[model samples]
Target: MLVDIGTEEGNSWLGHIYNLQGFVQFRLGSTEDALSFFNKAAEAFRQMRRADDGPWLVVNYGNLAWLHHHLGDQAESEAYLSKVDALMKKYPSPSQDELHAETYAEKAWTLMKFSNDRELLADYFQRAIKMQPEMVEWNTSYFLWLVNTSEHRDDGLAANILEKMRVAQEQDPENFCLAACYLEQRGKKREDVKDEARELAVKVLRNPVSSYNGMRAILRVYSNYISIDEAIALAEEALELHPDERYLKRCAALCLKRKIRYFRDRHTNQSMIDRAVSLHEEVISLYPHFSLVKNIDLANIHAKSNNGMAKADQMYQDLLKMDLKPAEKQLLYNQYEKYLNSD
Candidate 1:
């Protein structure tokens, strides 16, 4: 009915339906589809000259900005955010509590992306947090932001953030990634964090291989303090699930590299080194665009494994053939010369 009546006086009502549909799509993670509907709604607003006349336009622009940012189009996202900023300036602050909370939350997220001002960003996050304390991702992301900032790192702020995340997790049991991230950020030395990270990684692994995030958590747990056998087993499981995942392959390769060097059994360890080389080659083959970095790693791994200078030189030559940023090209050149000088 909405589509059938999309023209005439019915067009106004149809536009609202499209706007709501776009919002629903955004919430469901169909961002690209949401953007298409939002664009249609935006055109309707433009044709009706209603862009500056309603609160709906304000939220619409903000949603568009967020969607564009997720799409990796920062320039387009900023442009839409500028529109929201202008709209906010023209309107008086709403008396409604919900509107106030949403306004602060959206502004806080936007400001966090806009500037390097930790103090200011923290203030905004705090306002948003006060409005909705149970929003775990927002709180944890802000907390991580604080943890990464120079002033907050030495002040035990990450610990406080971790505590908040813990409480949030208890309230929301399904938030595995959030729990994994919080535990991962807490580092691996503490027994509590290590146990939690291991648990979360196990849960995450059982779900899907497409989750780069879950794989990262599992890798970090093994990389820091887990036993060689356990780490190797987990890596094997992950590789079986996600064969084309370069990051997971890299994680497995790194573990093998360390195990090969550190273990008491020389013959058994050499097999591990050979496996790491093979995994690195698979990653390189799958992601040729990153050949420069991949080949460098492969060359280093071969050199360490006593593969001799010939194979290493060829890997370096392959890296140099690609179009590279000046710094990347220079780094590869320096390494190549060092390899040539090696006996």
Candidate 2:
């Protein structure tokens, strides 16, 4: 459909479509296909000389650089990166930054979604938000990152973050930002936020935004406030609408795991656990970089099942050998220790 629309819309518009296709293909693990799409987009922009130095071209060049780097073609990667540098120099941003808000936000989101480097993730998000403070999505994401990366629980910090979220929500009441904010507050045991959070969850779920962030926010709300069955149902519904979204798949798998954990003794829950395992395996197969976290969850699920003890033990051993960050290593150790104690 995008290809068809792009064909009818001409080169400038086609460039954008190609860029979108490249991102989708890259997420789907078709790096070569992604490279082709990005290259075609770049060519389209170049042909339209007026747009060759536009912000869109920055995206094309940046994606090409990233794809090349991923493919281990450092020469090609650096060449494409040099193109971005040249473009930035030719068309300087009003803020005197090397990259535009769009580019920063793109990189920030990519890192937030795929990478575990919290410091880099926070820095990129801060850069993007500094430039585009009114962007509700970025604000919501930035808040989430702050909540997640805090080494210790700080009530004052949480309250400050919540106030900022309230300001953002006021600016964009219809956005998913409020849902995220309320959910975060509810998680912190703010009883006053529960009713409001539930209301926002219903509204967001009823009219879910068709974006990755939107889906994640809704899933987070359901996972916390609603029953496991409802969360799974919502995830399945969202998956039907966005069949290619691996994050939604992960959400559904996690929901199922929750159900399994909650009702492990029930015979019916066995099928749910099996299905959750299958989804986790599929996610790992699709994106091996996500394996460590997904595998940890999978190992925990297996540890609870009667027939999966050996496999769970093997997974734990393998995970312990992997080079993990201090926080990640601590989490794994704690979970494994808990499992041992449970036995």
Candidate 3:
């Protein structure tokens, strides 16, 4: 649909669509196709000849570099990386940071996926927002991160951030900022925001934005503010759209676990626990280095269900053997103790 629209309307619209397609293809592991789409996107940007638009091409070049590296073509990867450096130098952004908003957003997102450094992730997100304050997705992401990190540490700071997010939502009524803002309010247990948050969740889920980040933002709103069932449903819809998106799969699994936890009755439904466990297993199989937190959740579910106790014990032992940080180990022990104590 985006391609069809782009075909009818030539210009920066086409360039942006091609860039999105490239990212989607890259996520789907179609490296060669992604490279072709990125090349076309760059050509489109060059044809447009917008001074500021050249900086936008940095993401395409960076993605191409990463894709080439993954394909074991070190020379081609280096060439693309060099091209990105040249582009940054040739078309410097107004921030003079040597890195564009796209680069910062990409780094922030990658860190969120694979790294445990929330402070660094927050820094990158802040830089992206500073460079492109008008970008709704960046604002939403930064706000979410602020809320996550500061919810218990500093209520005053979190309130200030929420106010800023609320102001941003008011300025751009149609963007995803409203979703994030209302969701934050809901997290504070404010009854006034519940209806608005639900409305925004439905609105975003019905007509989500075109970017992967946009989809993830929408999913986050659903998972955090909306019902767990709704979150799982929205995740399933997203996975149907982007079948190879591991993030969506992970989100779905997390939502399923949340749903299970919502039920105080451990014997509510055996099938539900089974489905969540299966999803977790699938995630571990697909990404071996994935976070073990989900595995801990799975073990807890098993123990609560009074089924697969042996497997749960084995999982707990495996987690203990891994070299985890002191905090992480303490968290695992706490969760295990709770699981053991649960009726």
Candidate 4:
């Protein structure tokens, strides 16, 4: 996944990817790759800030300190630790917080990816944005993160939150993903966004493909408001434009799943089921780390298809045999119960 990000994104994001990848490698017990990634992260940060070093390197240096300590190099560890201390003394946090603004921002981004602690995550983002108002991406990313994280909520976003998002969306004109999210929130609040969604869809389709290109979010808006068939068509068009892009594939599959799983009254055709099944299977292959969720989606898709209960049943049984974490096991159990009740 880090390899997919490459260095095409902004310098700060590239450094973030490298830093997270370094930590993942170390956790996997590959100290050499971890060291390499940490060095790459330092360089990326240097390029991002247009300097050799800054408070941004605080986490990088701290990572180095920990890595060296684990490697039994007391001198190296102490040297890196001293570097961290000097950096902190020279460039203290902008706020009363113990961590620098950059550190807070990075921690917020990292934690958002791995955890669901809503209050802690929102607080970190708030601190980072308040301290470093110049970093526009942080604000946009924070808004988008909030929008995405609150997807399963029964109640939609509040008016004040929407107003703040609208302001942020205006400030960062180039972030189409945030724009799509704003539109989605408005639609959820019973606003008329059909024409706006159509225009945004055209613009997103024209833009170069990216992780934050807004296509996925746009598909969601279209699937919910404009037309599910059109959403599937849009996803297919994007996938055709970039066949190897796993993100696009996931988007296509998700659009198809929504159409099949919910809008079954709209011409429940064989080709749609086959396409959804195939796309989910391919998505499972492309993102093995997230297969549990995809696999459950696949099973549900099968259950809704013609004469596919056996395959779906067997898949659920297979998942039951795997050594999943407690959370995943509980989710599977809940979903399975729903699947059985549907019968």
TM-score for every candidate vs. truth? 0.57, 0.60, 0.61, 0.89
lDDT of 4 by residue, 119-186 (tens): 98888889889988888888998998888878876456888998999999998877788899999999
- The 10 consecutive residues of candidate 4 with the worst lDDT sum are 3-12
lDDT of 1 by residue, 1-343 (tens): 1222223332323344456667768889898779988887667666664453444467678778988988899999999999887776666454544454445554555555446776767776787678667655556556445534532232334555567756765665654545555555555325456576677778877754432245554565566556666777788887788776555676677667656545436444456667878987887786666667767767866766655457776777777787889989898888777766754
lDDT of each: 0.63, 0.69, 0.66, 0.87
Looking at candidate 1, the ten consecutive residues that score lowest on lDDT are 1-10
Backbone clash tally for model 3?
0
Candidate 4, superposed: residue stretches over 4 Å from native: 1-7, 94-97, 206-211, 321-326
Worst 10 residues of 3 by lDDT: 3-12
Best by lDDT: 4
lDDT of 4 at 87: 96
1-343 per-residue lDDT for model 2 (tens digits)? 2422324323324565677789889999999899889988778767654544666488889889999999999999999899988888876665754567657766776675568987887788788778768656667666655655652453424666777866766666655544564465556554444465556655655553333234555565566665556667877876777677665677678777777766454543566778888899988876686678788889988877768889999999999998999988998998889878765
Better of 1 and 3 by TM-score: 3
Predicted structure 1, TM vs. truth: 0.57
Clashes of each: 0, 0, 0, 0
- Candidate 1 ranges beyond 4 A from true positions: 1-124, 144-161, 185-189, 192-198, 210-213, 242-247, 250-254, 257-270, 285-289, 306-308, 317-323, 329-343
